[model samples]
Target: MAQDPRALLAKADKQASSARGGFSLFGGKQDKLEIAADLYTQAANAFRVQKLGREAGQTLEKAAAIQQEINEPDDAANSFVEAYKAYRKDDPSSAARVLEKAIQHYTLRGNFRRAATHQQNLAELLELEIGDIPKAVAAYEIAGDWFQSDNAEALANKVFLKVADLAALEGMYPKAIERYEGVARSSAGNNLMKWSMKDYFLKAGICHLASRDKIAFKKALDSYVELDPSFPSMREFQLLNDMLEADDGGDAEAFADKIFLYDQMSKLDKWKTTMLLRVKSSTTAPKPPLLGCIEEDDDDGLA
Candidate 1:
């Protein structure tokens, strides 16, 4: 006599459950794709026992598709996730596949933010990985932008400093300076951050000078002095003195006077003394020299 279909179905279901249970606890370390395939196969077998041909067919199809992904996956991490989710309730394999898909998708993006997230997940998967610092720096910078947009200046500044440190490590002083400036500028508008400005301005000035940005150097120096009178940097001191004396806009007569004063001081103290006395004895206030007159004087001297 033929067995009752319901009893046969119950027996098949029990066997399927046993297979799935063994598969789930068997290995803590297995390929995500392989485990997912096994679970799907078990689910299909159970559905077939109940004569649910449609569900069985669907489960088998999902298994094959997921297996193919492990072989030659593309940019469809999202799709993989969806498939994994749909079958995960009955399968631990599916859950693992979902997490793997998340990593794959993020890694494919190549953007600092995305790569950072993926790299973090990947790091958890392995003990030792190379080039982590560079990735961390890039991620921190990207996170800085996100934090800035969300009005988290303190966090942003922290990340900005990390970027500067990385740039310095790469021997990219100019790039490092730019990153430092971002930190300074973000702090500038707030009174609480005012104390930081003194150091920030001085550092910016030094970087500007090194980069040959005379205009930026001058401006930064001006800010630095305003914040603190005793700012050190013999280079800035000399530059400031020359700039003040050159207020006549590079006039040859003014330059000659500078040279003359130096020469007199070097020759004899009495000569400088006499020159100072004469300068103080002028009967009338001197008029400002016209810029055009300096050019004409230059032309006449050349001719």
Candidate 2:
């Protein structure tokens, strides 16, 4: 007898329905959950064969949920990831949702590395697909923390930089500066990343200027100089020093003109351009309360 795909799908569905009924009768029994998960998996396969991607994704997600309930978190995470893959071609939002579920299950199962990977994936999806910068930053921060916990320092630092970049774009300068500074300090011993510390310090100083916190900006400049005294000779460093001097000398227009001229002449990259533009805007706008006072917040307490 020839096999009928639709008949198989219907039978799988019936099995799933029976398993759902058994949930009420069996009261969260592991065996019942296993049966349900198996039935849902079968239904998902049938749906896939029938080219019903949405149904396949839904069935797979159901199986994942049952697997989670039955304490099979690894299985649940894999199923959720499969569901995400099934939905990704047609429904990005649904795929992202399932990917988040997979991340959650992996996290709950103490699989920090897998959790961090999924978190990074979700962050990229939020940033590129959804265009949600704040949420993307939050996701990236979580991923960075997980990666750090897993001793993936390089990956963690990369993710932390992403969070800082997004925070700067969102005008969260203090947070951005803190995160950038955090990565710089943490990478102090790594030869490959040490070179980037000066750039991070420069960016953090730019963030301070963007927040109109001259004291913080000066402190950041001092910190950079302490790290690499030659920083004072760099063109960017000189530009920043000139701005601070103009601010001190009460030459607002000169400061503004200097920024404008440098902005035009430097042909800065997108990140630098964005940071400089933000500083320009802040220079004209009324300064908010000081939030970047790194000195007072820094507590190298008594030995």
Give the TM-score comparing model 2 with the true structure, all chains together.
0.75
lDDT of 2 by residue, 20-129 (tens): 67546544555656776886777787777767777779889888877877788888888988887777666768989999888877787799998999899889888887
Quote the lDDT for 237 in model 2: 82
Clashes per model (N, Cα, C within 3 A): 0, 0
Q: RMSD for each model, in Å, please?
A: 21.7, 9.6
Writing each residue's lDDT as its tens digit, candidate 1 over 1-303 gives: 433434533444444445445455544322545556556666666665666544554565555565555653432444344344444444434434454555555555544454344333333222122344555555556666655655667866776776765554444557667787767767766778756655455445434533445666667666556555655443334433443344325343453354344433333233222322232223133423432232233332221
lDDT of candidate model 1 versus the reference = 0.49
Summing lDDT over every window of 10 consecutive residues in candidate 1, give the lowest-scoring window: 271-280
Best by TM-score: 2
What would the TM-scores of all predictions be?
0.36, 0.75
Cα lDDT listed for each candidate: 0.49, 0.76
